[model samples]
Target: MNVVPDPITTQEQASKERENLLDFFARGLICTTARAVGADHGEPSEEALTKARAVADDYLAAYEEWLVKLTADNAAPGPQ
Candidate 1:
C-alpha cells in the first residue's frame, strides 16, 4: 500500500520524456537543413528545400501542441 505513483511525479516524468523527444526531433531537423543547403553544387533544389522546411515546420507545430497538452494534463486533478 506504499510507494504509489503521484500526480506531480508522473507529470514531471512525462514532461521529461516530451523534452527528450523534442530534442531529437530538433537535432534531426537541423541536420536535414544543413544537408539541404550544403549540396555539392552549392545550390539546393527548390523542391528539396520546400520539403525540408515543411517537415521542420510541422514538427515545430506538433511540439507546441504537445507542450500545451502536457501542461494541461498536469493541471488536472486525481492520479493524473
Candidate 2:
C-alpha cells in the first residue's frame, strides 16, 4: 500500500507556506512605501485622488520591481 503523510504535517507545511507568501507581499509593500513616502512612513498626506496619482505616476517602476520579485519567487526551487 502507498503510504500517505500525516494531516498534521500537511497542515504545518501549508501554514509555513502561507507565512512565506505573506512575507513576500509584506516586502513588496515595504519597498513601495519606502519609495512613495519617506522612510518614516505615515498615512498618505494627500487625498485619495492625489494618492492615486502618486501611484499612477510611478506605476511602471513599481510594476517592474514587483514583477522581478514575482518572477524570482516563481523560479525558486521549492517552498520556503
Candidate 3:
C-alpha cells in the first residue's frame, strides 16, 4: 500500500526545506564576506568575524520580511 502524506506533514516538510535553504544561503554569505575580508588582510579578526555573522543574521531577517510581503501581495486578489 502507498503511504499518503498529511497536509500538516507536507507543510512541515516544506518549512524544513525552506529553513535549510536559508541556512545554506546565510552560511555562503558569511563565508564569502569572510574570504573577502581575509583577502584584504591576511586573516579576519574575531571582531570582524563577529560583525560578519551579525550582518548575515540581519540579512536573513530582512530577506524573510521581504518574502512575507511579496507572498502576501501575490496572494491578494488582483483587481477585476
Candidate 4:
C-alpha cells in the first residue's frame, strides 16, 4: 500500500538532500581545482593560481550564504 508523506517531513528530507548535494559539489570542486593546478608543469604561475583561488573562494562564500538563507527559511514558521 502507498503511504502519504507528511509535508513537514518531506520538506526536511528535501533540505537534507540539498545539503548532501552541496557537500558533494564542494568536494568535487576541490578535486577539480587540485587537478587543474597539478596539470601545469611544476607550479602554476602565481598570478594565475591566485586568480583561480579567488574565484573558488567567491563561489564557496556565495554558496555558504545561500545555504544559511535556505536553512533560515526552512526553520521559520509557515502561515496557518
**For residues 1-80, could you state the per-residue lDDT of candidate 4 as single tens digits?**
99975554577797776555555555555557778888534455556555655665577679879999989988889952
The regions of model 2 sitting more than 4 angstroms off are 1-9, 38-80
Candidates 2 and 3, the one with greater lDDT: 3
List, in order, the clash count of every candidate structure. 0, 0, 0, 0
Candidates ranked, most accurate by TM-score first = 3, 4, 1, 2
lDDT of 1 by residue, 2-75 (tens): 88655545877967755666556655665666779883443445665555556656787787899999999999
RMSD of each: 10.5, 12.4, 7.2, 10.1
TM-score of each: 0.42, 0.34, 0.46, 0.44
Model 2, position 39: C-alpha lDDT score: 75
Candidate 4 TM-score over all chains jointly:
0.44
Model 3 weakest lDDT span, ten residues long: 39-48
Give me the overall lDDT of model 1: 0.67
Better of 1 and 2 by TM-score: 1
Say which candidate scores most in TM-score.
Answer: 3
Provide the lDDT at 60 for model 3: 74
Question: Is candidate 1 or 4 superior in TM-score?
Answer: 4
Q: Model 2, 1-80: lDDT tens per residue?
A: 99975564577896775455444555555557777876765554435335444445366457769989999999999895
TM-score: the better of candidates 2 and 3? 3
